[model samples]
Target: MRILLTGAGGQLGRTLIDRLPTEWDIHPFTSGELNITHYPSVKHRFLNLRPDVVINAAAYTAVDKAESEPEHAIAVNAEGPALLAEAANQTGARLIHVSTDYVFDGNKSTPWVEGDTPSPINVYGLSKFAGEVRLINTLPDALIVRSSWVFSEYGQNFVRTMLDIGLQRRQLSVIEDQIGNPTYAGDLADFLIFLAQKPQVKGVLHFAGNETISWFGFAQAIFQAATAICPAYASMQLTPISSEQWPSPAKRPRNSVLCSLRLAELGFPSSDWRARLSEVVPQLLAANVLKKAN
Candidate 1:
């Protein structure tokens, strides 16, 4: 099968490219290579390649910066997906789009199901939600996978930031109110590939790490895991703060844990986030140590 993977430079994109089944013919493109916001560029490639599957991992992900750049955000996050959906429709390719938990307002105490009403609190979330609407309108059969708190060794994320901060500062403060699952990109990638084979799967589905925890709790776990590799991370004093104390231009949801009911029904194995974290934290810590030595 011919698969065209966008956002090749990103954490999830890289993971998908690296871990996708070897038999599939994968054509991976970074944002620099395939500008999804530009229709002509996106069109030419889709027409030429005519891939059996188009996995759009590309996105404009700067949450705070998006507040000031609404047009740019919409262009990439909203309009880009529309373009891909249209192209995929024309090309007869199945499009799997990656989205975020931010689509819903953090008002609900329970994990968000696919049917929940989306009330995006910030420009970034609104843009992603808009992208979902556009994709569904364009292709009702399109598979939209919504996930949250994604982290991996490949890119800038909470896990890497916490590990770096712990090494530098004697004290660290993390927001405790914002709650969600901390999904490993590698695991999500694996799930995506699994879904690709299941032609029956369509519409929006939520896939995240099994456990839900606040940012503060996640930080505590990061420190706990990394301490085993580098003792320097242990010296940092961790403090929990409310979202109000750590205000940003982009307002975040207080709680956006996603329910994996659909995922479980499909026979996807539930993953223990802590166990997955254990596997990657050592690699991340070791990289930090090597960087320090360099």
Candidate 2:
């Protein structure tokens, strides 16, 4: 199968490239190589490659910064997908897009399901939801996989941030009110590949970590895993605080946990983030050690 992948520099995109079957012909493009929002560029690339499947991992992911830069966010998150969907429809290519769980307003106590209508509260969420709507409207058969709190050793994420801060600081403050699943990008990448092979599965699907946790709780788990690899992290102290205590430009949903029952029914269950955490922390610390040695 010939696959066209966007956001090759990102955590999920990098993971997907590493994990995808080597036998298949893959064309990976970073934002610099192929700007999805540019109409002529997208059209030219799609017509040239004629890929069987197009996986879109490109997105404007700065949740807080999006408040001040709504235009930029919309351009990348909303317009980019629409352009990609248009190209995919024109070229008869299947599009698999990655989205966030922040689309909901966090009012619902239960986990957010595929059928639930999205009422985004912030600029970032609004942009992402718009992207989803545009993609579906342009290409009705496209697959949209929504995940949450993604982290991996490769990217700038909670796990790496916590490890970096824990190395220097003795005490750390984390938001405890917000709750959601922490998805490992590597696992999400694997699942995306699994979905890619199955063309019949089109529409919105939620795939996240099996465990529901707050940022504070996630930090605790990160440190717990980190302490085994780097003993310095054992001395770090974490304090949980409400969202209001740490003021930000953008308002976030208190509960954005996704329901993966539908995905589980499809034979691919949600991954255990704790296991992934255990694996990634060591890789991060080992890389740090190597960096120091170099």
Candidate 3:
């Protein structure tokens, strides 16, 4: 299979590259190499590569920073996907785009399903929702998988942030009101690769981790996992606080948990994030130790 993957430097992209079949022909490009917002460049690459599948992992994911830089966020998260969808349509290639759970306003008490209408409360969420809309309009058959709270050993994420701060600070306050699934990039990558081969699966699908918890709860879990791997994290104290207590530039959904009912029907259930977390914490600690040694 010929695959063209964008956002090669990102956590999900890196995981995808690592997990994808070694026998397949893969063309990976970082944002610096191929700017998806630029139509001519995207078209040129699509024409040259003519990949059977195009996995678009590129996105502007800075939720808080997006309030001040809506244009930049829209260009990458919204326009980029549209351009990629157009190119994929022209080349007759299947486009599998990764999206976020933030697309929902978190107003629903129940899990947000694919059929639910998105009413993004923040600029980042709005941009991602716009991307989903444009991609659908451009290529009706394109698959848009929406996940949440993604983290991995490679990139800057909530897990890494907590671990880094835990090592330095004795106490940390986290938001308790907001609830969502914490997806592992490796698991999301595996699902994406599986979907790439299943051409029949198209449109918006929610593929997040099976477990759902608030930021504060997630922080506790992170610390728990870290303490087992690194004894230094045992001293860290985590306090649960409301969203209003933790001031941020962007407003997040209080209930952005996604429902993966469709995914379950497909026979591939949602990933166990706690299991992945156990594996990831050790890798992160080992890397940190190695970094210090250097």
Clash counts for all predictions:
0, 0, 0
- The weakest ten consecutive residues by lDDT in model 1 span 263-272
lDDT of 3 at 163: 81
For each candidate, the alpha-carbon lDDT, in order, equals 0.91, 0.94, 0.92
lDDT of the structure predicted as candidate 2: 0.94
Query: Which digits, one per residue and each the tens of the lDDT, describe model 3 over residues 145-231?
Result: 999999899999988888888867999989999999999999999999999989999888888888889999999999999989777
Off by over 4 Å in 1: none
Clashing pairs in 2: none
TM-score of model number 1: 0.98
- Which candidate should be chosen as best, given lDDT against the real structure? 2
The candidate 3 region of ten consecutive residues with least summed lDDT is 260-269
Q: What's the CA error at residue 153 for candidate 1, in Å?
A: 0.7
lDDT (Cα, tens digit) per residue for candidate 1, span 134-244? 999999999999999999888999988988877777898899989999899988999889888887899999988889899999999998898887777778788899999
